[model samples]
Target: MSAPGPSESGSTTRRGAAFADIRRRQQATRGRGRRTRSLFGMMRPYRGRIAILLVALLVATAASLAPAPLAAKAVDDGLSKGNLDHLTVLVAVLLGVSLVGLVATVVRDRLVGWLGARLLSDLRERIFRHLLQMPVSYHERQRAGVLVSRMTNDVDALQTMISSSLVTLISSVLMLLGSIVILISLDLKLALITFTTIPVLLLGSLAFRLASVDAFARTRETIGAITAHLQETLSGVRVIRSYGREQGHLDRFHELGDENRRANMKTVYLNAAYFPAVEYLSTAAIVIVLLVGGAEAIDGAVTIGVLIGFVTALDNFFGPITELSNVYTTFQSGMAALEKIGALLDQESTLTDPAHPRELPDPLRGELRFEHVTFGYGVPSRGGSASAGGTGASSSPIVLHDIDLTIPAGATVALVGSTGAGKSTLVKLAARFIDPSEGRVLLDGVDLRDLRQRELRSRMGIVPQEGFLFSGTVAENIAFGRDGATREDVERVVASLGAGDVLDQLPQGLDTEVGERGGSLSAGQRQLVAFARALIAGAPANGDGRLGGPSILLLDEATANVDLRTERRIEEALELLLSDRTAIVIAHRLSTIRSADLIAVVEHGRICEAGTHEELLVRGGAYAKLHEDWQRGTTDAPSAAAS
Candidate 1:
């Protein structure tokens, strides 16, 4: 049989694509429904308060309904009969109704406000906790700003819905229901006449909902993009300015802003046309009521008092329709936000602790091992061309593969390798930040996966090349390493590490502000602070005599960013810190790690050579060649500083 022509295949492909799109949309709809249900389920715990809130809303709405009827009585009974006392009574009754409404409104607002605040706090905490629980690979694949927007913009939208717009929507609904019942009871004909305009309002609302659903979602996405771009730009502003690309970044920002403005303007355009159209329709309905009621009164079918009452009741009916339209934008924005937040909450941490985790041995030996470990970030490690992270199209690019290595207790093992040689990946595996796809990483002769992550990590101290610090004083940053670490503890930790230069150089000594991420401190200063922090980890458990820190110290090119002078000081600090601790150091300078007990030379995700520094030099293999090059001032290891 002959193969089908291109046009025929194209048509078939298009049909399949269309079907897939429809299925995806259906799945999304179901997911949104589930998320909405879950959201409501979360609120079930506050059901009692919600019940009270509903009662208050209903009472306020009922009180608002009383004014129109009272006015009618004042006109028909008091004025028509010229009874001054009756009019005064009606006026007083109206004032009392107003007071009731005011009180109900206060109660409803307070409850809604409290609920919104509590829920927002809970949701933000949940998102942050979830993000923290996620694997390192998950973070590697996501933009920081996008994750930040989940807690900020998304939660804010839902907060507004709960605090204000939702209350308005509910109260308006009650108003509509109450107004229609009163109108029908007083004069069925006029009620039916007003009800005739209902279909028109419904049709308009339906159109608006359909047109604005995607628009509101797009606005949420555009704002997220804006946030991501702003964050990225700020983070790399130094590079941009150095490259004289300030105008380029500004132009990019303007592009993002334009996209956000365009998305928002879509809703603005819809509201401009839709809400005003609603107002116009309600006005037309009121005019119709007045015209018909006036004629009925003139013909003596209805009294002027009834006519006035009907007109006043018409405001209650139409006003709600107008109010609902006003809040539609907020409702739509909130629902769109809910969809994004729900998706984030649905993301489960890929690495879960064992159901019954093994506890680390007291005074952990900190012996580390990687057995046949194979891993890749968000890609198949076995083999198949991955688009990202570099590889031949027909081959898989694994970050670490079939690796076996061991560090005996209290031994310093330095990892010497070129860029992308799986040096950092090994450290992450040891830390259980990301699990290996194929083999096992063990600490204290037990599989790392069998132990609780916090328990496993509590005994290991990791210091990256660039020391990251929080926005706080140096003492607080140091105290972050240990719970309840007082100023004395900080001083002791610092003194133990022999990093007096770190504090002595600071303007406020230990109390010096590090600024955001220690930006105010020099690179060397940050590293010193980081080392002190690492040394304080297990101090409390040891009665504060020895540093009693993590038994394992993982230093990933920790000295690569500093100058020779700082490196010497850091080396001096490490000499003291490394005593009786299993040290895994990823070093760029061969001279620094000369005393390392074991040196492993890694190349292209595999360990090509392992031995003492002098032994590797004697072998004259990959490590020897790297050492020769390094001695000649050609250090390739620190160029990129690991993957």
Candidate 2:
């Protein structure tokens, strides 16, 4: 077997020989405890349907066994005696048995198909819900493409195995077992001859399964990696084109694809070598039966009818043996996929609500506070692995240290700092995207950890730095934050934010389609739409036609990506979204910081300066130095109209 990569390996492992031995034991124990049990647990919900399907399979097997014996009876009781009426009656009996078997086969297939579809639907829903509830830090550390592959490609492989191999294995085993018993009953000596070659087929099947387990596992891993690479490439296509790296990406993709091809080919070659060996053994068994049974029949030791029946029974037995080997390949692949999926399910979300969650008081005041907050990306101890729920180095380095800040009701607080200065991280904490490693974040005098996440988040509005939009109409995207929002509500928010000009530029206004991730809209248009979405979300109602969203707004670089003209439009929209709410803005542009009610200059996870923009400028602190740089840049560029 190929060695495990950094990612397929466990979260913790040891390197030295003694430690490696311990690690292996731990992994084996874990596998024995949960892997197989989880796989069977997935099937438990469909046990009733599976039971009915098995009954159909057994009936089909009994019908199939009847035809061989009836043929024997026809030759012995009618053909040999020259009784024309008996022959006709025996032939008619065979036809009835065949028809019954055909119907049973159809019923079995329908049951299998239905069960497979239901299991797949349930599995997909379970995985998606689990992933959605995982801490945001888990997603931040994972590749988008890898996660998508787990949801799509891995699940598809599992579905194929469940729908085909599982049914085939059960039916084939029943047919093989029933045929062997009938063969022994028909002619003892001929059955003994058939049993001699059965050992060879069983041994070959075992060998084939062992070899295929590793081959299919490798194939699954390679496909997941290739999918992840492709997803990353597609998402960054603009960067590749701008940097003239198209050929480089194509070459890398081809390399990964070639690896996948080789892995699959290995499985193909194993099957090629295995199935023919089974066919050879099966044919050899028939030849032995012919040689032994023919002599015995001619010597008056066995009847011709019994000889013919034994040969037919042998064929039925070995055919299933060969088919069973083929099913083994799929079984191995399904097990491999289950292992990966189980690992994902085993991951525990680091953040969860208290057992008895406390609710905020009726009518929240939109106040937020950070009490001695300190956060980092990793574990505190030496050699301890950090949770996948976090990103960056394994060794924890403090990002925010002893931060105690509070924003009163309906205040705007802007965070300003250089890149990597923890501005974004602080904003994320306010939204409880990631909790502080040390200290507590409270909303309206209550700890955030004590409140249910959905309840807390639903009462606040958050606009991310990227301004991502789903594939939908302009109106749909705007109303996404507030379920059941009316057309009038969307229009009022649009006009209130001065985003009507953006609608005029669109092809169909509110009905215009935004491509995937809002690709069809300009960066500025997406920002304005996101702003309007935030504004309309959680709006308070006065029983009239007016509804306003949550009283708190979190803006993370709201104007980071837009051009100057687009930035002005977003700034105008932002003014309305931020009005009458507690606003925390992560600033990238100088204009945003300049207009803040309070500005806190962040440096290496600590607030080095805090005051009004002018107060900091007059103090000549870190904020003053940053303002000086901004003024110098403005002097070097042409002035534009303000929002």
Candidate 3:
């Protein structure tokens, strides 16, 4: 296969960079809608719990208000009247009310915590479910690290608001309202004087909210940026070290961290300015009330008890105002989080299940067909390769255009091409990982688009060029191929593939940890394990003839990343697995090239040659040229390896 020119590689890099920038801007600049609606929408499912919580808050508020009035009664009706019995009774009532308020507070908090936890759980699950339904194209266009940040940091901010900040907000509003009502009843003149500062408080709050909203939005963006940078850098740490680019990566990380710091500083500055101003206004209100109420008490216009009660109400009022300043900050942060998370939830996936899907046949014949298929990334412009991670760099708009091909049931067909010939895209079509933009892929005479994805995919087995494994034991990774697969089933598949020898070499055999992405294993070992996983997922049934495994196999250069010995083992395993199944294999090696039952040579989004190996050789066309090149490379490999 010829290598891409400098222009093609440069274009790919530029396109990838441009695409990433566009995505980040979209995430950052999404419309800022009212968070209350989104928050309530999530809480709607727990309406019963919310109603109960509100009732508890109301009870608590009422109980808290009881003490101020009782103090007044103790002063005016008991102490002033020299009635010891009344004073004692009033004190007892105040104590009882306080205790009831405490109990109610505890109950309210518990309910709030429960509701918050449940909402977070539901939100996380909903995001994950939606993501699962999204098409491969959507994920390809996104950065996994950014998505992780959305799922973690962004969601966590909202969770914090729910679990802790919400209680403060509710308590402040309730206290503020209760304080105002009681102050009016105690002494209307004094209450009106105290309420004079209300406008200042309102204005300050509004200003803070407006200023802090954008600050917190930037904070969220910086957080995502830093997280994405860290994840990307660490995932490629080995590459950085090998290339001696650690300092360059460190500088980049420092830049991201610095941006995060600056964003946080903006919120800090806003809080510093807003909170102190609120406190000053609150204190000013208190002093004026103290001065005016003292004059009224001295002149005998108001009772000492009434003045004292009014002063207490004044404290309650200003206290909540100060508390609400803090709550406003938290709310702004939560709102920022909601905007980011809401954007993610609003993303529409291109791939969707048909309203009414046709059921596939019970015993699938596994025949595969592509009819006049065409596809592009998103725009008309196209350049993508069939190779893993290759975006075919084409000056034209089409990637795969009007290509036609078929693989008969129980036949082994190999696709051979240059790096960007759309072989992998063809394989993806067979797996229905993506839909063709202009044509149809059929399985057993039924259009793939008409079949349910889950049922259709369940009957097919695919192993991509890259073998990805999760963090788990070797046995667990293998068993992941099929749900509910047992240790015995794993062992049986291993034994059949003669993979027991590989397992025996591990320190803990089947229990050996694969680490993240099977990092604990060599490339060859990982491939072997992946192959075993595929085998077990599609293992043949018992003697009763009931189908247990997949009927179709799609292998995209399964041996591309392994050593010669490993490749031989994989080929041997493939021989047994492919004997009774329809198979489509993407070939890069000469050995794979010669062994295929039918070799299809793809060129520029079309099949330029198709025939048996011997027949193609006799024709002396593209296949013949590819065959000669393979032979020449095989001859030179030994010398190249020795040097």
Candidate 4:
């Protein structure tokens, strides 16, 4: 995009500043719309109801003003001329109009309230649906509390504007206009005096509104901060207790509470001054009207009933103005929330599915290849860091360089390395989580990037070092990879993985709740669940002619957490699962690595040794040293555990 010009940029900045002002004013008004445009936008969906309500409001206004005229007529044509018949008829007409106005007002309130609620529901659902569709990275950067606020408080603020503020604003303006017209008709000079305080009222309202806007915005920010603090503290409450830091956490929480309190007090202070100031101006207008109109009425320039009607109309007019002022706070808060939500919606995901995706053919033969693949974690280089200026140790470097490898279909390969070996990074590259900075990863001679990510991921199974589980039943966790899978399907998978006995031993069999993050399950059980999930996911579809399933199975330290006995059971299941599939196991145990068709010892970002177990042992280089270290560690583990 071309850079904006000074005038264009300046105008944009000015517009932003104006919006900021509006946001502040909106917070002050508390869902009251500063701009008619925003208010109308919210009301647009309920235009029909609003139209009906408007008509009713007009009827009510007309009916209400009608009584004043009848009252005046009752005095002039009945009591003044000693006509009791005229007086009774006029009194009864005034009473009938009052009843009609009351009914109309009630109906108008109901219609507006219903419309406001419906609009709020629709807006909230739209925002939530959009949020669900957003990519993972978008969620990673945003605060949970802020998102909740948008869905709740922000939507609620809009509701207030829709239900009451908007209608009152319109009706008030109409009432004020009608009153002005009636006052003018009665006597021009007196009418001018009544309206003289209007400019001052408007100025005071605008100033207070702007100040209140700032106050409300601060209040909202403080509230959001408090929410975030509380959420974080609760989430890590266990850690806090373990560290004996409860008092420290309480102090921090108190600080946040105090900040929130101060912000609220500031808003309350502004509101206190604002309403009274507006009321004082209204009082001044009333005084002016009475003083000027009293003299006119006494001189017979205006009648007593006309003067009385004008004061009543003026009182009615000021009610809407007061309501409008009250709504400013809610309006400010909603606008501020909108700006935040809008920013989230505008964020573009770095990773996106292609516009026209090419699907991978089924019965995918897992032939993998890496061609001169040089990659990095995309970590920014800082001065004097070992990875900087290519001055790092040969055993550790910034990037994986010129990696060339190929794994034939249905082969089992093991990758072995120490810490900082870039082993996990290599697997991530193979999974296509991150694209290579240079070269490419190929699956069955086709560049992995050419295939749809969804299709690619579905065809492969991954078991991470730490098996993460959601809050659900054991059976639900197992069946997660395959949506709409039946209980029979889950049972079969559990049986196939030899975890049937484990499931039967649970408190409620497969129906037992796993607790959040499978807290109720042991680490070994969690691993087994992940293993079963992977096995079930890799199994062939019912219609497929092929016996064994997934093209590739990527196991990243899959058996690390399990005991030797459990590992042996897992290995047995792995053999069955890997019978006709290519398997790349990031081996943490010598027993697992020894069984592989090929073993590659990765050091730094390159393969230092590659061979079968027997071949690597005979070679006695990096592989032999690693095997020796593993044997020694295994020997020492029993002693350490016993101690």
RMSD, one per candidate, in order: 4.2, 5.1, 7.6, 7.5
Estimate, for each residue in 513-574, the C-alpha lDDT of model 3 and write its tens digit.
99998899988788778877877665455676333567888889888888776677667766
Off by over 4 Å in 2: 1-36, 83-86, 380-388, 391-394, 540-547, 565-579, 638-643
The candidate, 3 or 4, that scores higher on TM-score is: 3
Q: What is the lDDT of residue 515 in candidate 1?
A: 89
What digit string (tens of lDDT, one per residue) describes model 4 on residues 27-81? 6455333333454575677778878888899988788667555666777788778
> What does candidate 1's lDDT look like per residue over 55-133, in tens digits?
9999999998987788778888999889999999999989999999999999998999998998888888878898888
| Of 2 and 3, the candidate ranking higher by lDDT | 2
Worst 10 residues of 2 by lDDT: 379-388
- lDDT value for model 2: 0.83
Model 3 steric clash pairs: 383-391, 383-392, 383-393, 383-394, 384-391, 384-392, 385-392
lDDT of all predictions: 0.84, 0.83, 0.81, 0.75
- The TM-score of candidate 2 is 0.91
Q: Which of the two candidates, 3 or 4, achieves a greater lDDT against the reference? A: 3
Best by lDDT: 1
